[model samples]
Target: MSRLTAAEQKALAERVLDIESRAVSALAGRLDDSFAKACQLCLDLTGRVVVTGMGKSGHIARKIAATLASTGTPAFYMHPAEASHGDLGMITGQDLMLAVSNSGETQEVITILPLVKRMGAKLISMTGKPKSTLAKAADVHFDVSVEEEACPLNLAPTASTTATLAMGDALAVALLESRGFTAEDFALSHPSGSLGKRLLLRVADVMHSGEAIPMVTADVSLSAGLVEMSQKGLGMTAVVDQQQHILGIFTDGDLRRTLDSGVDVHKVPMAEVMHRNCKTIPVDILAAEAIHVMEEHKINGLLVINEDGVLVGALNIHDLFRAGIV
Candidate 1:
């Protein structure tokens, strides 16, 4: 190992970045009919895409497989070395093989080419050597060749690997768009992630409903509304008609205002003290949208309504926070 001055280290790092950036940029021109064919083959496949590679390429292949799977194309990584040792059984005639090899001659990957072909699986090869046996055997070839490696000695896989990863991203994104994959679809693939929480969580899933909802009739005394609010622990109560149709909402703020006006809590009706025209949301809307509504109205809670404008549920910022939608 060799130690260098801080300035020399920075300069070397910048050189490597510049080399890898240029290598990825060059791949844009290489996207042509072959790239389209590769994406189409993936799209038309009835089964999963089997991504295979060896050594460093295997790491990139695994990532590409994840991207493809998460973006709507079913895919999984199959280690080339493991494939020769019976993992090749994972590949089916309905599946497609995406092989990655910088030199286009990784022995582990090449060794399975015959079996993959015999299984009638489609093959898409990414390689620097266009004329290598792997490239020739592939149904479609992607040229990820780079002028040179970012490694000063050009003996390590640096720029080539970067280019390969970029190409894989390109393929994943192109296929994602072609398949009309939406953010909600992506969320379904990542239900434990924050984006999934925002996209899939509906107000009904988090709101207080049924007997848990705090409610008071329009003619109910303001003191009764306060009692309902206290019992439900929502800091507010809906003023509704006999049919549970929301007429207005009385919150802690409304109570403070009513008291400031010297209104007697025991005498004043909820309809007289409550806030009409309160912001309400449908029970089916995303909880994230509830946050937007609350922020827009400068309020801390919301009334969830049904299709018939009936009060179905209630939720506050605290509820959203508990549900991890905040």
Candidate 2:
């Protein structure tokens, strides 16, 4: 045999993706009332979706379980051989079983069907053969049949596994929609994920509160604002009114410009040198959104305000970095 040329490699890769795409496309056509029923079973389930299979199907099963769990359906995968040993106890009467086997003759998978039935858990089978033993034993059957494997020899599992994974995603997404799974709901499930942190982390949670906030009165001398800025290490201080309502903001840069104008720091009020009409954000806004605002405005910090437009908090670029929003 000779080494494959670059052109030939490109052709083969396309062939594989084409075959898998066809397989997944056919799955969408095969979806009918049975697919809906599988979703209904899983949607109504109080317990998790117990996914089980062997070899290639097992990997697909694990992926299916993860997608299901992430999208709002509670789910997990259990190895068939392990299930027969002792892991079977993980399934409960309220749970649903999603068994994936292309040939429908995986002995380990079939061996657990009766036990799953004994637990009063609903079994949904995804297989190439509708008349196969596993399909006949299931409460619902989804035809995950593929015309051919992408493998040239037609021996390795390729297109069939892709179809099963696609079908599992379809099922999970259907359940997600039916259950009205919102972004907030998904965030709660994935508190440590990037999307979760963006939606759930509020300015109040990450902003400098109480003594950590840099503050000064409008009547304070420009030199005094610098002292507050240096002591707080926030690079700036809030210039507030007599009642502490934010009138403007003063920073180290403001002090520099005022000094260049030949003004006395001790003589000038902070209000005279502070930036009027400064942009501010609500204290309830997400920290992720704060990053976007700061980037858009080309600024490194923000003044947090309440409903009455009073400054309640202060945050800088370093705060977003600490919260992993930067």
Using lDDT, give the best candidate's number: 1
lDDT of 2 by residue, 1-326 (tens): 75999899999999999999999998877778887778778877888899988999999999999999999888999999998899998999988899999999999999988888888999999999999999999999989999999999999999999998988888888999999999999999999887788889999999987888888998888888889998888888898876668888876676678789999888888878899888789998889888989899988888899999887899999988888776
Query: What 10-residue stretch in candidate 1 is worst by lDDT?
Result: 28-37
Instruction: After the best TM-score superposition of candidate 2, give how far the Cα of residue 309 lies from its true spot, in angstroms.
Output: 7.0
C-alpha positional error of residue 105 in candidate 2 after TM-score superposition, expressed in Å: 1.5
Residue 129 in candidate 2, Cα distance off native in Å: 2.1
lDDT (0-100) at residue 259 of candidate 2? 80
lDDT of 2: 0.89
Clashing pairs in 1: none
RMSD of each: 2.6, 2.8
